[model samples]
Target: MIDAGALTRCRHRVHLDAAFPEQLAAAPEDPGVRQRQDAATAKREGIRRTLTEHAPDRWVQIDREQSARRRAEDTLAACAAGADRIWGAVLPLDRDVGRKAHCEILIRDTDRGGYIPVIVVNHKVTDPGRGAVTSGMFEWEPREDLARKPRGQARDQMRVAQVYRMLEQHGFASPALVAGAIGYGSDVIFVHDLTAILEDYDERFVDRLAIARGESATVPSKIGECRSCPWWPGCEEQLTQTHDVSLVASGSRADLLREAGCRTIDDLAAWDQEPIEDWPHGAFEDAVVTAKAWLAGAPLVRRYSQIRVTRADIEVDVDMESYQEHGAYLWGTLLNADGISVYRPFVSWDPLPTPDEARSFAEFWTWLMAEREAAALSGKTFAAYCYSRAAEDKWLLDSARRFVGTPGIPTEDEIREFIDSPQWVDIYQAVSDQFICPAGKGLKKIAPVAGFRWRDADASGEASMSWYREAVGYDGEPDLSQRERLLQYNEDDVIATKVLREWMSDRAESEIPLATDL
Candidate 1:
């Protein structure tokens, strides 16, 4: 059946899920997906309990342990009885469209005399603005009384829309055409105008339904979603064998290039015509260069005649470890000065979403600033490096803002000034400007070229995410061994940046071929 995810999932995946269910079942689910699903399930249950406790007499909860058919019967009965709240409600499937919805909650809309679907999701649904918010425990309506940022959780809105469709089929949809979502760990509900969402939602739903039903042909294209897709291996193999343009170009850009007659890597590399009007300036050229690099079997191509990286007498490589979106829990640093290198980690062992994180971050900032001050006192140039500026900069600013009055925590302006200064260098940006990484620009992908290897064979950001759960005792007793492993992994990451910087400085020009020459 077409679920909410089908609305947002890769088109190819939707086809595979429906037409080749057996293959999908054979393929192992991504560990991260499994973990997230489990967490979301727990969070949903917690929300149900919270709502029930607040208004036990008004809430009607269907037993999820029952079959889907039976759950739908009970849910409908509750709605017909004018129940104020219904949890774990499976709406009657829309056979015409083959759509179904397992709503987290259906709150009775007194004005509309029908139920409004509310989805409980495991991630933050709101950013930090005035949003249409309501209390989850009470009957909800769109209101701006609560402080909430309306982060457009498209999936959540689509999920509600899916349920709305099913509700319409059952003749129990709210006339107001609105829905709500409660983010995990939050007590407030963010409402959505179904009218505003249904236009785009309906268009995509029909398209997805056709693909799922085999009425439309589905072609695989590499996308950001492929990282977590079960069909990625087969799709990747097919794309590789066919020398698809997506191998060099990204997302829909590959499709656009294909439509523009550059259907494959060779075609793109050989194109000598005027730049495609659809492409941004220089992007098409970059794609052509990348295609050439790929054909030459060069993972990276130097963009210039000579490459240079910022170097200092006192160099610090920094890498921060965050536990999902909860908070940054670990700040790993590699300090090199006066012919000596030291690895230091400021870690908070406490479970994340805790105040202790502020303490750890504050300490790390204080220490780093002190080191920079010491370098100035010694009249030595100092520079701080991080592989990618995005993550580090995010936490630096976020931590400062989150823990405003906390001792030793730098102000957001101070953090911004540091990142904006020449003293703070993003090695990833340096790599991007100096080289074209056809494969990828991730540290794991490029560090090997520079002779830098992680001590742990399984070292990866994805692997670290799982290890973090164990280290922090998310399920049970904390695994101290995993904690040590994370520290080692973090240290290795910082060291890799240092190694990459040194390699770019001393060996890159002599070792790597330039793009123009290629």
Candidate 2:
């Protein structure tokens, strides 16, 4: 299904890669040293020979000396009919097109500026023999045409129409928010990241959408969940009268008791003995007491903490790195209720693997946890975003579980309330959204936009970081100096997060309409 979206994403990858003069230019400094000189030479030479030999009469502009010209030519022949060629376009592709078939051609048109195009996409390093164009290109569509299609419909024609309709409906601002909200849902995040990747290369994706339609009814409804999810509150949803209560742990007791033929607490209390699953003892006394007191054969009201932390206990805004170094840092600003910072951003590093290294990292966590308890200094606890360098940090969870109590917390409501209230042990759930950004959610993309920027020269933003870790040097162990550098690198992320979160909250309140009527 060759469509605009697919092309756009490929185009985006190509365009983003354009910044790397180190990869494309022939001696970026010298101008003659295209990154892959040998590959370019071989490919150009092959093209020159093939074109010259195949159709002797065909005109050949032998600009082997000029890298841009060579690339331009390669791009031309790569397109259909090799007549109407394009340049400035191939720059947006996912493949780090090797010298093999990485050249492009340009053509001047009277109406538009110039058509930049895809070249020999089939020559991609990862997937062999599949040219960009031949491999299913996206189609162009009108906004009205697209709006009629349903989501999850992946047909090529339908996609073109759907994309146009979506673009017409959301435009940049709402789409961006939509993209963010989508990232909150795993399924939606996939779509957002995919669209971002595709939008870059495909010209069809860059079309101007109708702004009126962009502000469609669908925007608010879809975005509501992301904006209001209880998890980010350090507690996603509390038991509302209907949906909330049914969704809680205590609700499970209702089910259990009912199954045991003990619908009411009177039945439960008067039974000869409580069954194993009857919520035996101390399960839900308050609600039971309240219900028994009513004596109207009435139902009991179960309560669950629906707390949200406008503030935090240990506000550690985190970014994770899994390559050579498992790097992390903390921007823990323990503040008083009066907004005075007790402890500012604190950096920490961990190169330890295997949970057994608890001995080695105890000091690291102690310091981290100590910052959380900073409220002790002022008797004012805060909230935090609890995330880790690794996804499966069971030990981190276990540690929280182990130490969360010992303060005489007797009931699940108390535990839930304590965890959800302004005094949150961790704040990771709040920061890790359901969406995926093309550059990712790290400070590189997040920092500068929030009126702050990343510090440290070695700190390659998300793109470079991805290249550094995922592409090469992904060994479990990174350089010692690099490890420390990464930890410090993370500190800025936490700071960035704090800054960004507050900034965005303010902006949304001031700038956005915030009606959410869909």
Q: What's every prediction's RMSD, in angstroms?
A: 2.1, 21.3
Predicted candidate 2 versus true structure: per-residue lDDT over 1-518, tens digit per residue = 12333332322223323333355343223221222243344444544454345445433343445675554444444333443323222222222211112223222222433222222211221211222111111111112221122233222322333332322322211122111111111111111123433343233433212111232121111112222222222222322222222122233454565565655434543445534444532444433333332333222121221212254433444343332222222223333335443434433333223332333234435554465567567665545543333332433433334434433213344334444455443323333331112222454554454477777753654323433332223445545555445555656656665665565445423422211210
Report every candidate's CA lDDT: 0.87, 0.34
Off by over 4 Å in 1: 129-139, 144-149, 184-187, 278-282
Write down the worst ten-residue block by lDDT for model 2.
180-189
CA shift at 310, candidate 1, in angstroms?
1.3
TM-score of every prediction relative to native: 0.95, 0.30
**Compared with the true structure, what per-residue lDDT tens digits does model 1 show for residues 303-374?**
898898899999999999997778899999999988788999999999888999999998999999999999
